[model samples]
Target: MAFDYDQYIRGGKLPHIWCPGCTYGIVFKSILRVVDTLKLNRDDIAMVSGIGCASRLPGYVDFNTLHTTHGRALPFATGIKLSKPDKHVLVVSGDGDATAIGGNHFIHACRRNIDITMLVFNNFIYGMTGGQHSPTTPSGHLASTMPYGNVDPSFNIPELAKGAGASFVARGTAYHAAGLDKLISGAVQHKGFSVVEIINACPTTHGRRNKFKSPTDMLLWMKDTFLPAVAFDKLPAEKTAGKFPMGVLFKKEGAPEYCETYYGLVERLKKQREGRA
Candidate 1:
């Protein structure tokens, strides 16, 4: 049976701003599928996003949503999670919005092991902002700011998240729609900070500049390049070159979630005050 996307989408929010052949829509639908599979109530879900093409996603969803300032989605979502710990908080961000200006917050959120799911849409270029180079932009990639080809090193998002202490870290590509749904569902169901970096294509801004003839070419590249985690591990290093592992790249079970610890302390303090009274 076809999933009823209309139930989750906000009314009159269609005619999405994404360009033709953009894979952000695929990522969005994957998220909706995860929500549906979990049987999550829209009222109990808080979706937050910062300024960027990917950040516009929250506006189209019927869940409690916050469109925040550029690179500040994590901070806003952190607040929401801390205040209403029972609510499921999810943050959507672009590569730049998650790693460049928001780098500090991103690392700290992982360090805290907060119970928030962060979905990073990495198209390599700043699609909404004139194809500027982002932190995840591959070295030697051409962008508006790097018309001569970028020399800066790109971030390995999964490694960064795992190193910073995220309890769950995963990677998925828009090309692997079904696998993406599983990755997202796992991330959402995880107990602590979860980061899922979705590799998608921005045909209009990034693809044309990179000489990708069409969006299909970009997706096909992803299909050929990304391997499932177990398969990636079994391959020889030489064969794995230029290829990345999809699925859950890292997961640290039994880590302490931030809100639980914080609220526990608050309850203990209240108990102490009651004892004095």
Candidate 2:
């Protein structure tokens, strides 16, 4: 049976703003499929995002959504998760929005181990904001701000999330649309801070500047470069030099979720007050 996307999509919001050959639409559909498979209630989900092309996603989804200031999506989502601990809070962010200006929040959110799922769209460039070099931009990559090629080393987002105490960390690419659905579903079901760094293509900016013949070429690169986690682990180190692993790279069970701990404290205080009375 064909899945009815109309129920999940916002009315009259079609003609999305993404450029031709952009893969955000594929990512968006993968997310929707995950939500449907989970049998999630739209009313019980809250999607939040900051300023970026990826951040525009929440506006098109029929859920409780927030489009906030640049680099502040985590903080806002944190608040929602803390206040309504039962709700499934998700954040959609870009490479620049998640790891550049929002870098501090990204790590701290992991440190706190909050129950929020963050999907980072890592196109390696600031696709919406003049094609600047983002923190994830590979060294020697071209961007509007680095026409001579970027000098800074790029961040490995999954490793960074693991180092910062995220209980769940995974990665997927736009080319592996089916795999992305599984990765996102796992992140959403995880009880503590979960980060899914989605490798994406920005043909208009990053691709054109970096000499990718077309978006198809960029996607093919993803298909070739990223290996499934099990397959990736079996390869010899030298053979895996330019490749990356997909699927859940790290997961720590039994970590205390931030909201649960805070609400537990509140309940304990209430009991103390009752004893005083």
Candidate 3:
């Protein structure tokens, strides 16, 4: 039986903006699968996204969605998660929106261990506003801004998340759409800040500029390049030089969650004031 993805989409919002062969739809379907599996109420969930191709996702979803300003999704999600701590807040952003313009927020959100799930759709270029060299654009890739190939080193998003103190850090590719359901589900279930980086292909912009044969070719490259975390661990440095590790890369237990700590402080202060009275 085919899962009706249209059920989760906003009514009358059909004909999405993403181009043919773009993997955003695939990644989104996986996320929706998880939402269905968990049986979460739409009212109890909130989705936030910054400006970008992937960020347009919130506008199509049925949840309480906030389409925030450029590179500011995490801060908006932080406020939502803090104020309505009971709600499950999810942040969807592109590579540039999440790691470049919003880099500071990305790191600090992890450092604070806020209870929000951040899903970064990493297509390696700035898709929406024009194909520019993004923070995660591979060194040799060409973009509109980088006609002669990109020189800026790409970021390892999962590693960055781990370094910034995210308790749960995972990587999944659009080529492995089924696997993403599990990864996204796990991220949402985690207690502290969780980052799930989805490596998707942007064929319309990035692919044309970079001379990729087709969107299919780009996706095949991702499937061939990235290795599962367990297999990646066994390979030596030289063999795994440019390989990305799929699956959960890092996880740590027992760090104070940001909203919980803030509320605890408030309770303590309230108790002290009551004692004085």
Candidate 4:
């Protein structure tokens, strides 16, 4: 049976902030599918996002939303989780907001293993604030700020997430909506911190300047770039060694969750205060 997205989407806003044929819509759709499949109460959920075209996700979704300061979605989400541990909290931000300016918060969020799901929209460039190069922009990738192509190396997002102690980490591209939806849905079900990096399309910014003739061409390029986890593994040792494999990059067990730990600390302190009182 096909998923009826009509119930979840805002009908009045038939269109979205993304450019025509952009994969951002596909990524956004996957997220909505996650919420629906999880049977999550949208009213009880809170989504926080930083500044970017991708940041508009919270606004589009009918949830308790917060459009926060640029590069601060993690902190904002952390506070939300700390205050309302029972709520289903999701944080959505672009590559620059998650990896560059908000880098500190991102690592600590992973370190804490808080029960929060983070979505990283990796459009490669800073699409919202102009076509500048973002943290995830690959070396030699052209951008408005780097007409000669970007000189900085890109971070392997899933690898960084796994290394930072995230309980669950996964990667998928916007072009693969069903796969992305399943991965995101799985992330939402996990009890501890989960990070899913969805390589999205910035056709107007990342594509236009990079020589992609149209948005469809850009999406097709994304599809071509993906190597299945098994396919990646089958590649010769040297060939597979450097390429990023998209799947459940890492999953660990027995890690202490942030909310439960913080609450335990507060309880212990309260007991001490009672003794003094």
TM of each candidate vs. truth: 0.98, 0.98, 0.97, 0.92
Clashes of each: 0, 0, 0, 0
Winner by lDDT: 2
Candidate 4, 170-257: lDDT as tens digits: 9898777779978898888888999999988888888888888888887787677777777887888788544567777788876899
Candidate 2 lDDT over residue span 1-277, tens digit each: 8888878999999978899989999999999999999999999999999999999999999999999999999999998999899999999999999998999999999999999999999999998877999999999998999989999898999999999999999999999998999999999999999999999999999999898999999999999999999999999999999999999999999999999999999999999999999
Q: Which stretches of candidate 2 lie above 4 Å from their native place?
A: none
Model 3 Cα lDDT, one tens digit per residue, 1-277: 9888888899999688999989999998898899999898988999999999989898888999999999999999998999999899999999999999999999999999999999999999988877999999999888889888898998999999999999999999999887899999999999899999999999988988777889999999998888999999999999998787899988887889998999999999999999999
RMSD of each: 0.9, 0.9, 1.2, 2.1
lDDT of 1 by residue, 118-222 (tens): 999999989998899999888888999998999889999999999999999999999999899899999999999999999999989888988899999999999
Minimum summed lDDT over a 10-residue window in model 1 is located at 203-212
The residue-level lDDT of candidate 4 at 260 comes to 92
lDDT of model 1 at residue 73?
Answer: 93
Task: Note the Cα lDDT for every prediction shown.
Answer: 0.95, 0.96, 0.92, 0.86
Please state the error at residue 200 of candidate 2 in Å. 0.4
Comparison by lDDT, 3 against 4, better one? 3
